[model samples]
Target: MSASNAQQYAETQIQQALVDGLLAEGFFDKVETEWFSAQEAESLIGQLPEYHQLVSDSAQRLWRWHYDAKAGLALVMLLRPGVTQAWEKVPGSRVLQQRQQGQALAWEALTPQRLIRAVYQGMNALTDTLDADELTAGQQVFLDALAVSEWQTASSVDHRVDTQRLLERSPAEFFAIMEQWASLLDRPYHPTAKAKEGMDEQEYRAYMAEFAQPVGLRWVAIPRERMLCGAGVAEGDQGPVAWVADEGLRQRLDAQLRERGLADSHVAIPVHPWQHQHALPKWLAEDFEAGHCVTLEVSDERWLPTSSLRSMAPVDGSAHYLKLPMAIYSLGASRYLPAVKMLNGDLSARLLHQARAKDTRLVEGLHLCDEGKWWAYMPPEATLFDEAPRHLSAMVRSYPQALLDDPSYRLIPMAALGTPLPEGGHHFFDDWLAQRGEAITAQTVSTLFGELCECFFDINLRMFRLGMLAEVHGQNAVLVWKDGRCDGLLLRDHDSLRIAVSRLEQHGMQDPCYRIKKGHSNTLYHDDLEALLFWMQTLAIQVNLSAIIDTLAGHYEIDAASLWQVMAQAIDTQIEAIPFEDEDRAMLREKLLNAPGWPYKLLIAPIIERAGGPGSMPFGKGETTNPFRQAGCAASHDRKIDTEENVAKESEALERKSLEREAQESVA
Candidate 1:
């Protein structure tokens, strides 16, 4: 046959093969029958350019039969091929024979469900041969059809009974198993309950009265096995109080029951009731130790506490009322008590006092509680300057200067935040870095780095004198600016605070002072330095010795070279100031010399060259030294800058000469 005629014949056979395969395997039911038409087959054939030359008349005719068999059936036929002539052109025919042998065993073992899975998998694989959109639609239709059958099957008694059994075992386990089952059938399961637990009748009534004010008695409803049961909060006429049940709690209860070998016995499972049985008064009496509790009283005369500032909403479209006895707690305190109440009365007194002192109507009203707590309420007209920590943290990154200038500004103990220093500082740095990436200029980053280093130097000096250790990190140091100039710095989050035994004894303050005898302790200095390095890296700043010196010089209004001299002198004068041993100092020196982009790369070039010698270095000979080697160079550069001012002068002269020559040539 002529090549053109053979090619034409091959195309016809390939098209026929596709149609035959679809028909043989009943793929028309999986995808639509219309999808396997001549037009679609031509389009698919055009996509397979690699096989064009090889698809001859005889190959096309044989392939037509193969394609007609459907994916699963065609695959089987390709593997077994009853006739020897069918196997003649196929490459790696032995591999197909082996696969066929294994597939035969699998085919025998497959149940109806397994067969369905295989059919779905086979249909999906053929999607590439059809229009992508059409293939997707067809798959969806097939899945929808299968879903109807699955639903019908699930509705049967056996399936329903099995599902109930699974659910009853453990709510969490049951839901997990159901999720797996649904995934197989391409379905989703949505559970409504949030929690599963119930208090006794008395406790329920008491809780309702305490929490739900004004309303006295309320009825509660608990759902079990799709049925809602009335759990009366109080004996009288009350509406139902409902709460979502937690599935996890239910699962735990179920597990506990089984573990205790009491599966057969009735368990007192906790259930959330729908409503409270008693009025607010009765609930308060039982729940609150004090007979009187805080309440929101909004007339034009009432004051709003800062603690309840976030929660208040306007009423009557005119006035807002905040709940009394407003609570506030430090972030660190949250671990001990996740929630805390701020007594409205104490806060109110403080507000009133401040208002009187300022001679302003800042605080509208005040209320005091028996527990020595006060709530001070402010109207909508109240100024934000009254709040300290919240306002400071919120506006610091953007309008840091304003926060610093506020009259209420106070450096509270870092322990007030309730969380440890290092982690909090790290998170703070991350948040700041994310925000600063878009907003900060290179100049600003450089300035911030320098200022931070100076702050650390000052803080370290203070710590040395006091014989105390402080956890210092980017997060710990809050930079406050006013009028485009850094005005204030605050360090906090003091859970990592450490004081030497001698200092603690000398201070002799009983209420706040704590002592630490040094012995393998994770003290503030050790942790803080690590945190400082972390912040430096996160900000993508090089933390080499020169960088540190540059920062200090900028902060103190001295030349970089002069700053290094000063630092060296300071170090010498305060030999006893630092806790690090001589060996540690040497190691630190080596690290500084080798740090990347250390600005004194040429200084370490000789050492690196010496290490390289005649033959090529095992690890890249040129610029890319091991990181440790780089760090050593950086450390050495820093030490040289500190101890030898003349070296810096010489380096500066070379740099100036190079710049001057470049400028003169450019002019010419």
Candidate 2:
């Protein structure tokens, strides 16, 4: 057979296997059949590229994410250039779909290719709104970067003898490998940063955590006045205004900024070396020339890119993490920082920190890594739609150093934990277990797994009850692991957090933002805050914790159903224990634990619908039946059965005792 035909046959086998697997796991929203026309299948086969068994499946070995067919179809058009033209080639193709039990099912093929499109389309859709008719050179560069990044990720996940060397790597190194694995699997999807010009591709991969990239950030300093700054303060500490770099880079930056009259201005912003070189020039050619943005390449600090593409941390084991807006489009939007958000970045986070601080458990267990410091240039009459100003922003985030109170406590992102080691011997969980010398058996692992679920549920519950709702999806949610145990959730990205004004009013908590912005464009919102928060947790659980549970269960032969049950119970337990309650909080509690149905963000579809820009809310929400509520029912049923069994046993024992007493009396 031709290679293409062989590829087609293999692809069908994989899809069928996945369909059967999902069926076996009963992981579907419901057991339903979808009928598809021969035409639709053909169209879909054309649209979705292949998911290879070796590399792509290797990532799925980490977690099986949700599949939305409509989102998939939409994403296919969005990812490649000439969306309309591509469809035109297949003119007869309908808005193709399948019918499951006579009900229409949107067809989403969860191929690595589709995953790539979901991310690229989601992100590029936001940027591509301004461009049309084939890819520009820069846009092509962005796309090329994504493909290469995808290749790096795909190659890395192909765990085999070749990756045996990777086992010798450190936690950071291994986790960074996971970071690359996740980069392609992003919510909006972005490939790893393309290899820098003149840099070896192999070397570039080494610099990225996914590629297990070992590299330092090149820092630059821009004048404060030259950049639009945001750090939430009613006043006081300025936060971090300077762009971050290594010690040597910092020394040089100080001298350069001072020499250039920038330090004198108290207006220097740190920049990522890649952004300064690759993205910045193309994005802000006129602005840089006009001196609206001025930078001094200071020192080179070794920083590792975390799972979140734009966020970077010190590779040299520094405590502070820098969150800079790169000009790259990853996920749904450009990873760039906008002026408005920068102005309010700190406040959004500070609001959550301060409010949650009132609750001791939350304060200790839930770390808010908000730096509140941001600096960026704002050109005169610059609107958000304009790319230059917003992309040139940087913010600093405080590492959850507090979570490190126990020397053995390590702050690992949920993504890192889910990532499989290239070599067969260990993974993130194995590493944690190794530290404590815990035996890896079903009973021990299951017990600890239950604790992990409980930790996640409670941490989210405490924060939500505190009236601080943020988008704590997989990337934002950090696992505070102590020895081999899961400690709590340490979250980053404060500006993404939303506060319920009504709930805050009840608690006498001040609103985080002075101005209210509608939609998810900013943190401040008056209405739907509770609903958004609720959905955010759902997204976090499904994407992060649930994904972890599924992976662990599948990989280790643990009962997937049992793990999910534990997660469900954890959710129920937290809702029952709301410390202080009010109407809004009560409603939130009801919806979380007992509501008939819950809403989940249909993130990719919205990006396609909006063509990637902020359409309605950049966070797309969809309704799903409340699994927690269902889990509650299941738990109740189990309890009732146990109660009945206990009653029967007692009755049987009492009857025997009475007979024995009667026999003894007769003998007397």
Candidate 3:
């Protein structure tokens, strides 16, 4: 069919569906038939009395029914698609018979009666506390029953409900009501209370350690429950170190400190001379008795030791820990060191090992602070001497300089070669040349360019392979400039780590494949592709022909453009290469022309322009059909002549022929 005919058919189908839906819901009887047309529909909807409210109600009902039907269909299809057909073949009314069977099952389970009781209970609670204006009687009852049923389902510890369904309710109402109900039932609940305060050094340490013992709490780095204020032990330092567990909770305390911001002022912890042995641990008894922990006597009339109290004012600064509930327990800064080390260590180690194998020395041991900060410690010459390297200071200061001077530091470094030259030192390309000098011949440059291209391709391919994406840019890559040569490169930062498909599968976690198997995954909801695009864009790479080819061919050991043709052939000859289900295969075919692996679609423009025959326009007509057009296109185009000229010319001719046929038809 023609495009116009197809559009008309779709419109007619949609109109019929809409009219049937409206009539079924009793809206058709309320509105005139004249209101069906686009202009008339808008005018009639606007002029009707209480139109906005009526429309809103109608839309809500429609959406609710649609959602219910789809959910029912999905469940039914999962159990047996032929159930609908079997029902149709029954002697009685099909819809009514199905409804009766469903109702009967529901009755056997006492679902309706439970729902009614829940609705009544919720209505009673609502009447006592909520304002009448908040909801009408009917709406209130409906919402209350929904809330109760949903809460019951979600509150079940064994059978987990859909998170999306749980999220449908307002967080404020859900949390408040759930907490209140849980409290009334004396049930264990997740706390949303503020953190506690005024914890002594020993108390704070014990609390932090205890808080971190739980499985879920292992990953948290900062204390969760207590607004702790006191001096405690630093990992290496001997003297009592002042610290705050709850950074945000002690805002008032922080404000006071800022107000009394004396440059050299020191705050002392309150210590009781007549120390209670019971309060002190066995190892700490001697220090406690000697007044090393505090300065005041416990028995002194003027000195009231507020050790048992939850909150207290600081001796000099306004620092204090406020009392909060048990649920607020959070991990301190020290807890996340291991995770930081694991991630950064793995990355740095990989890069360092690769560099070392190639006789490169760009990175050294990666260090993670107790505060979860990462630092790559590059040794001067792989051995520490009596004197520290000058570059140590430069490396320490480089982070600050990179952040401030080069916003693209994180992205550009990983994807490209050469460091950001110091202002006016040399142009990037020139600096790259100057360092390599005579060694950087045309052949070397070409090889380096190819390597850089392959690096990007591999990185992206690894992203897909791992089912993760890295927000790689220049800054994330560190180029070790020794004797004017790039000895090594490093990729850093964990915030950029994303889950790729293979990794998800390896973890035994549910992936997009689950949706595909269940018939829920389709082209319209291609979240995987969307995620890939997000990765590309975030990495500052355009989703153009070259970028697409590079990304798709990243894992292969070949040029991106050449890899595309190979992939196309593999699609035909090697089904395993596609690695998709039947539905995915159908979906992929629909999008084949625009898909990343199709070289015909990717090289059309460059090929056409290179022909320079009849109907060939000048190179810079601003109408180049290639999606990879950019300010650097002319340069890139010229660079490609040596490698890609023949392929590009052929593709361009084919595109021109197709365009001519389309033009001829339009004229006819």
- Scored by lDDT, the top model is 2
lDDT of 2 at 427: 46
Every candidate's CA RMSD: 28.0, 13.6, 25.2
Please tell me which model should have the higher lDDT, number 2 or number 3: 2
lDDT of 2 at 99: 24
Model 1 RMSD in angstroms: 28.0
Model 2 misplaced stretches (Cα beyond 4 Å): 1-152, 155-207, 216-221, 230-247, 258-263, 266-268, 295-301, 380-386, 402-406, 421-425, 433-438, 514-530, 580-596, 613-619, 628-668
For all candidates in order, the CA lDDT equals 0.26, 0.51, 0.26
Candidate 3 structure quality by residue, lDDT tens digits, 297-401: 112111111211111112222222111112111111000111222333344333323323331111231111111221211222332211111111100001222
lDDT comparing candidate 2 with the true structure: 0.51
Tens digit per residue, CA lDDT, model 2, 1-668:
34444333333322322232222222333422333333434444443343111112111211122223334333221111111011111211111222233333354444433444343433344453543223444444433443444444444344222222333555444434545545433432112322222224454454444544545555444444455555432233332533344556556666876787766554556576667777788888877687656765554556677666567766655456677766544443556777666555567766776766678777667776656656666665776445667767767766655453345565666764454343323445554454657745544455667787778767776766666666666667777766567767777766566667776776667766544344535434646446556545556765566567655654455544455556666666666675745664566557655566666545333333444443123445455555554333353332122323433454455346446646976896
Better of 1 and 2 by TM-score: 2
Query: Per-residue error at 619 for model 3, in Å?
Result: 32
TM-score of each: 0.24, 0.67, 0.25
Q: Which regions of candidate 3 fall more than 4 Å away from where they truly are?
A: 1-425, 428-432, 439-444, 477-489, 501-503, 507-530, 537-540, 543-668
Error of 1 at 597 (Å): 20
Look at candidate 1 and tell me the lDDT of residue 502: 47
Task: Give lDDT tens digits, candidate 1, residues 1-668.
Answer: 34444333323222222222223223334442222222334543343343333343332312322222333232221111111011222221110111223345121222222233444455555666654223344344333333333322222111211222331233222222322222111100101000011223333222221111121111111112111111112222111111111344345444554564533432221111121112223322332233112221111211111111111111111112222111111110111100011222222223223323331211211111111211122223333222211110000001122242343322211111111111111111122233346322223333444443443343343333333433333223333322233334443323334434443333342113222323623322322332222222211122222333333332322334343334333333333344445653444333322334222111111222233212111111112222222222233432232324443454455346446656976997
